[model samples]
Target: MHPSFQERIDEVGELLQRTKAARSGFYSRIDRRAPAKPVRYQVVGGSFGMYQIKDLTTGKTRAFRNDYKAAHDLAMQFEAKANRQITVAL
Candidate 1:
């Protein structure tokens, strides 16, 4: 036999509570808030063999010794500051 309307409603309520959709607000805030800008770092190499780390948004560059590791480390530092849970592409 098919479930009654009340029984179906109760089942859906339990499912929503299990998924935490019963109190979700993330979707409602999307239209009211501006999208976030993604952080990006570019590693540029100089002619003199030195490495430069550039912040794409600000056009600011920091110089590092001719070692790629140093420039990569600088990029990682920027990533840490931007979002600790996410990593930046090299």
Candidate 2:
């Protein structure tokens, strides 16, 4: 016995759906194995109106003289980059 044209098409569609589901599960397992740590930033005050943006994850620091806003902005940027998501349009 042979499948009709519509039945063949349906079989292909089911195969494609199964393949997609398996791929999704594979990636999900990979994601669970190595979870991402949230980036932490700290703004420290120094003498002579100096502000520092400290990245706790990497133990790196950036200094700003009399500019708290710039220091805070840099810290915020680092946090944003660490937490950003990649989106793909199909």
Highest-scoring model, TM-score: 1
- Model 2 weakest 10-residue run by lDDT: 30-39
Candidate with top lDDT is: 2
Clashes of 2: 0
TM-score of each: 0.45, 0.44
How accurate locally, in lDDT, is each candidate? 0.73, 0.77
Where in model 2 is the C-alpha error above 4 Å?
A: 1-39, 63-65, 86-90
Candidate 1: where is the Cα deviation over 4 Å?
A: 1-39, 84-90
What digit string (tens of lDDT, one per residue) describes model 2 on residues 11-88? 999999998778678778788543245458888887677887877877777555468888888878878876879899
Error of 1 at 8 (Å): 54
Q: What's model 1's TM-score?
A: 0.45
